[model samples]
Target: MSEKNHQGKRTARQRLAVEREKQKASERRRRTLIVAATVVCVLGLAAVIGLLAANSGKSSKSSTGPVVAPSGAQGKDSLAIPVGQDGAKSTLTVWEDFRCPACKAFEAVYRPTLRELTGSGKLRVEYHLVRLIDGNLGGTGSLRAANAAACAQDAGKFPAYHDVLFENQPAETDDAYADNNKLVQLAGKVSGLDTPAFTKCVKDGTHDGWVDKSHQAFQAGGFSGTPTVLLNGKDILKDRTMTPAKLKQMVEAADKG
Candidate 1:
């Protein structure tokens, strides 16, 4: 072969080698980028899952330990705290969350009427406490408050203490009731509720599991929200015109029936 031709062929081979090397390097860079992006996505998804799991743990943990129903708790699974004579002709079932503002509002409006009817042996109230706000607002206030109320039930002072809780309910976003001391202090407002046993029960979360079970029952009932008020198995709040007077009239009608 001529020297010039040999030189040209060798130069062409060298150039092709360089091009191949460049292409391989480019492919390596692309693969590295793809791998790095995949890793970031995986880590992000893991973080989200971990956060969700942590929240679930907090909620579920509140209900851990024993399911001790309060003394004299009635209804299915002893979930309902009964007020007034069981033989009353009319029954009102109230599913309430202590941390829920709507529950507080309902209590504010209907408390007097409930007291009157219950005292007269015309209506009985079956109160089911739940920890809904703990799940939604990320706190233990609802659970703590419900457990404390159960303690009052154990003391035979549920009605007075229950009214006190609603009367002194904190803002929806405020978790003041989560503090055991706060609950005990509020118990002082009840005539004879702040005994040593009551304090211990509130601090120890004696009825947490019961409250959790009540909440689960609330969920299973497919109700929309808190302060679910039912009269004689009919949802009363669904009536747009519902008021304390309407409730009284309905209970009177049920009593007559």
Candidate 2:
């Protein structure tokens, strides 16, 4: 071959090599851009998903709307439903859940003594409703019953209705109180308690926020369980030897003091 032709062919091959390298570099840049875009999209989608999850968690954990305390409710934030004379000398604070079997047991044992003391104006009871069972058992019975009790409180029959609930409490795992109709039917046992307004309050969940707030406070207080009975800021049930007679004696002593 002629020397000029051979040199021409060599030059042509060099140009081809340079062109192939430029195309390879271009392809690499395009692939890098696609990978970067995919990562950004995935990160953005992850961020949106995280935001939704956070909002859902907040909605489930926090109470919504205004807390409507029961009529005649007294105490910090009006979370307590008072059941006796305000001028009574001693205060009995009861943290309880209606669906709790232990609470029903406590009420069954102490109701007589409490009634007697409160009747004589020697003791006042501050009942704080909680929904611990609802949280533990995956049902709304505790919340519904507490709200119904608050409704009865509004009707000025809290003490009577409270006793009725405990006396007729269903099994702990029954979750029967979740039915508003059943609660209203039970109200029929209390004379002058099953009014239209009371029914509406029970069914509409009027005091749900107040009950939830009280439950939150109970949780924050680090209490271990339900039917937490306190007398003048002392945990009476912790004594393990506490009885109705003992509770009466303590209240009388406080009154005398």
Per-model root-mean-square deviation over C-alphas? 24.9, 28.4
Please give, for residues 1-257, the per-residue lDDT of candidate 1 as tens digits: 99999999999999999999997676455434433433322332333344547776465543357789999999898999999998899999998888776677677667889999999999999999987777665678989999999999999999989888889988767899999999999999998888999999998888988888887788668666667789989988766566677789988887888
* Per-candidate clashes, comma-separated: 0, 0
Per-residue alpha-carbon lDDT of model 2 for 139-256, expressed as tens digits?
8888999999999989999888888888888877788999999999999999999899999999899999888889878866766677777898888866745667778998999889
Computed on alpha carbons, the lDDT of every model, listed in order, comes to 0.81, 0.80
Give the Å error, residue 184, model 1: 0.3
TM-score of 1: 0.76
Best by lDDT: 1
TM-scores of all models?
Answer: 0.76, 0.76
Candidate 1, residue 150: lDDT:
94
Candidate 1, superposed: residue stretches over 4 Å from native: 1-63
